[model samples]
Target: MPTFADPFQQHQAEQLLQPVLIRVVDNLRKAMEASNWIGTYEEHLLWPEGTTTAEQEQVRQIAAQLEDADPEAAQHLQEQLSHLPMPFPGYELRLSQGEHTQRIDVWNLCYQVCFTHYDPDTPAEVDPHLLDEVGDVDWLALDEKAQQLVQVAFEQLGEGRKD
Candidate 1:
């Protein structure tokens, strides 16, 4: 397992955060689609360094205390808790919106998973260049999990699979 000390600082962080975020988003997407609800998916996540200086200082104090008392345990605790903020300010929400005049709220389930700390106001129009990047997203393709969900739903409905 890669730790923060490795050359993979950002990479490790993304590895953990991205999948978790994606799963949360996917659950929201599935729920919304199932209920025939529509909307953008918004995620409010914590950002490091977006905190106040006083809060950082408080964290540093706690870390120092732990380090002096028990260096080994302190290191482990610090590594695990490093991503967390001392005062824990709050999260910033990001919502997904469609192009043109169409805008949709995230699926109800998505909201459950994402759990916005605060309301997400309308976001600026997405960059057109982002669309080009869309094709590179392999996860967007229908996978076995999605196919299985559809299959089960159809079976439960007493309907045969469609050709």
Candidate 2:
């Protein structure tokens, strides 16, 4: 089994995953702004009466700020968000790794979204030598994991608008 030179490696991985989590939240906020509720029930649950214009505008403003700060990342985040089903308000993505365990938690204000675990001791499919050659973490692998988390979030939330 491969061992990280320092425990901080786990912290580094969490740092890498932060942007992905932020993007996920931004995407959900955008969806809410658009009145693109995941399902009829979700729609009703989130806004039992109806969404106020002020609420919609608030979400829009937050998105605008994020876009203005980094348009490229915003665009990429939008593209990824488009693929996901609608999410509830206040959704959160949490990730952490320990000596032998890696875990992800996706949830919203009201309930749990999805939970995943991985054994860090297990060898990955990618060649170990390649990692050494790069002298950098495999970000693509983390991105894929992030995408999977979003997919699982959507699935756990249930169906949304077809379009």
Candidate 3:
């Protein structure tokens, strides 16, 4: 571990880890995609994240009402829930470089990624070149790729069925 005596030292350390950072995130995503993390939906998911208890209770109440008032709509809601794809889980990152491979815990990798992006309260800006790669990185190109991946998740996932 390199101890930064000052901001300049920190900048150099950041530069040193830039390529590793990019490679980790990229390789992790690639490995996960190859492992079918996105295509397979878990049968256990009912309500996705951000669903409040109150909302769930309200749903239960509505479901009861629907059972008495209109059984058809209740069945439709149940069917929809059953068909819904599971929300993306905190997945493992399997990075393979030739004969070397690293299996990073999802939580720890998230922490590393987040820690890299952390901005201290000091005046040091650090440029925030997130996911730095070898040599100079084309950030604009990355932005486009990011947009496309987001769209794939949104389009393929379909926002959890707005219908």
TM-scores for all predictions: 0.23, 0.32, 0.23
> Each prediction's Cα lDDT score?
0.39, 0.39, 0.44
Clashes of each: 4, 1, 0
The candidate 2 region of ten consecutive residues with least summed lDDT is: 109-118
Which rank order by TM-score, best down to worst? 2, 1, 3
Question: Which regions of candidate 2 are displaced past 4 Å?
Answer: 1-6, 26-35, 38-137
What residue pairs are clashing in model 1? 28-110, 39-104, 39-105, 40-104
Query: What value does the lDDT take at residue 82 in candidate 1?
Result: 69
- Per-residue CA lDDT of candidate 2, range 1-163, in tens? 1234355544443343344445445544443344334311122223213556665555555556666667777776576545433324432333212222212232231111111233335421222221224445454643444444455655454434336
> Global CA lDDT of candidate 1, please?
0.39
Residue ranges of candidate 1 with Cα displaced over 4 Å: 1-14, 42-163
lDDT of 1 at 70: 74
Supply the global lDDT for candidate 2.
0.39
